[model samples]
Target: MISMRHVVFMNVAEELSFSKASQLLFISQPAISKHIQLLEEQYQTKLFERKGLHIELTTAGKLLYERLQAVKEIEHKTEFDISVLHDAIQAKGNLKLGASTTVALYILPKVLSTFHSQYQQIDISVLNRNSESVKEALLAKQINLGIIEENSKVNQIQYTPFITDKVIAVCSSKSKLLKKKNYSIQDLPHLPIALREVGSGTLAVLKRALAKHKINFAQLNVKVRLGGTEALKNFLLESDSLGFLPKISIAKELKAGELKEVFIDGLALQRQFFFIERKGETSDLNKGFIKMAKSIYNL
Candidate 1:
């Protein structure tokens, strides 16, 4: 169990305003201040720094926040386990899930539907964000599990390979770029490209692959940066710009003749989707879901 001061500090750290923390906790502003003061005195370090009307966590505070977040997750999991063991409630429990855009949009719908049908008692909530943001949410305990495609590894999180996905360069069927007998990877920089915005897992993979070929992202003529995969696909259908998307996502369009895959002689863009959770932390619910997903996807 965490102390009252620790809870107060977390609230203030998240909100970045003592008054907002007080309102969130339903405590007096002076009481919130006193609790933080006591914590600071005990630690013999300043936890926050004031910048005009805003407040930000100091180095020490940031460290404490990270540890405390883990503690909170453990506590939450403990309570959930106990409830599942004892309570005769109608609803089994809630599963908080976070996923990157690709997984959320292209992958999870059918899996989620099947899971819901099989386990109607379990309530599910999903938060969708970029891969980096999904990882951050998992670490902050805002989500119990995450599915992402980022290649960069974080020590605090453990990644289990979920599924293999490929990112391929694609264009509208009407694009003139298809007139060439063969497209070479070297020709990519001169073509008009539409890419996912920064922080996207697809974009990350594209950059790493390009770097291996001695190509910089700035060398590509990026005409637009879209935030969602669906939006990027729509943009491709309207314009002649080339874009990279998950093969699974564009299957329908490719079959319908609205889009065509642009093959570069030497370029093969592939990435793996991962089941992410905090290192050394696992719950029965998360384990069951991961198992079900693997079975459903035949992975």
Candidate 2:
């Protein structure tokens, strides 16, 4: 079994902030300091250097952190193994997961809830970010798994198809852009549009669809680039700016008539969402989670 001190230290190393690590671990700053001090004493080396608000790990600290990361993974796997040996139907352990904005808001809740119901003793935490952030979390080993809109081509990560979605062009009922029965991609150059930021799955699909219509995004009259789907939806509701978003992400708003899907000729944007993880690492917990996700999505 790994010590709590080691776990706490790993959290601190990952967060690079004592306060943030303490908050995440539900401990106080002083307690975090004590853990760090204990770890340093055991290693007989300084683990971190403090400079203003930022902290940097010493060489020894970096080495220790890398080992501790593997220790944490082994510790988690051992616990799950014990539970299985005991025939616990609900596989109980910590599951750290990340998801892009669209998947987090639309797809994950139902799937995670169902998994939790069967494994009531398991603790799950999810971080919501864009696809790039999700990829970062996986590479850092900060999250054990991730669900992302397929946008990147990172060679170190393995991606499996989780689900697919369609991008819908939407506008406020008050927006004049909806007046056109069939707007072509060429017509998009004339309207001010709101868009998801680069590296987002929605943006990736939209870019490809535009290329098919021979329209360069550089020429479009973009009003703003929003970070997340919710931000884009809120902006769309309050302004005349046309936006493209996942159809699943705006079901409620569209049902209530807060927004309407605008039709575009020669455009039917579809993209897959992928479950991603570091290549060559596997565990029963990770496999279980993937199985649950696949079953939930009926894939």
Candidate 3:
């Protein structure tokens, strides 16, 4: 097990405030300070530098944090492995999972339910964010595994294909644009488009697809940028502005005549969802979950 001092230090590093760390860890502020002070004394060096009201981890502190994270990961793995040895049929442990908004909202629910039914002993927690944030969480050791839509290869991360998702341009069913069965690529720049935020995997795929057709994203008139799939869908429903979204996400809306897919001639937008993890960091529990998800999704 990791030391309490290390745990306090991690919370402080992440929160950047002793008071916040205290609240998060359910401890007193003075105790949090004492733990840090003891850790600094044992290391014989300053772990953090105070910048006015804020504190930043020093170089040594950053190194220590990384080492502690590795230690914690190993410890968790060891506990899980030992548990499995004693109870081969029912693995018992906690799994921290991160997933991008699309995968978290659309893909993971049913799979997670099935996983929970089969392995009720294993506790599962999910962190939902965009693909970029999910990657960051995985790198920071905040999550053991991630499901993301972006396939841009990161050298420090390993990725495997999880599933294929299609993105399509859509507008409110009441929009005048629905009169046309198909639109020319040139019509895209003239339409007011609502797109996902910069870090989104949907936007990444859209940009790549646009670039493939020799069109620049800046050429399109973007009226609004949304942070989530649902928000964009809602925006589309309230206005005539065009938005691109995952086909799976708007299935119910499409069937209900709330949104209609608009096809652009000579344009096909598709991206693959990926199972991502820090390179060389796969654990047995991670593999087990991955196998189960793949079986559930038939990927």
Q: What's the CA RMSD of model 3 in angstroms?
A: 1.7
Best by TM-score: 3
Across 1-299, the per-residue lDDT of candidate 1 in tens digits comes to 99999999999999999999999999999999999999999999999999997899999999999899888867766665776677534336668899999899889998898778766767799999999999999987889899999689999999989998999999999999788757887898899999998899999999999999999879999999999899999999989999999999999999999999888888989999999998888787788789989999887
Across residues 1-299, which tens digit of lDDT does each residue of candidate 2 receive? 77899889888888899999999999999999999999899989999998887999999999999988888787887888789778767566888999999989889999899888888888899999988888998998889899998765799998888888889999998998877878877789998899999878899888888887788989989999999999999999999999999999999999999999999887899989888988887677878888988898788
What ranges in model 1 sit over 4 Å off? 1-10, 18-52, 55-68, 86-94, 118-123
Using Cα atoms with residue i matched to residue i, what is each candidate's TM-score against the true structure? 0.79, 0.89, 0.94
In model 1, the worst 10-residue window by lDDT is: 84-93
Q: Native-vs-model 3 lDDT?
A: 0.91
lDDT for position 156 in model 3: 96
**Which lDDT values do the candidates have, in the order given?**
0.90, 0.88, 0.91
Predicted structure 1: lDDT? 0.90
> Which residue pairs show collisions in model 2?
none
Error of 1 at 137 (Å): 3.0
Name the runs in model 3 displaced over 4 angstroms: 88-90
Which lDDT value does model 1 have at 78? 69
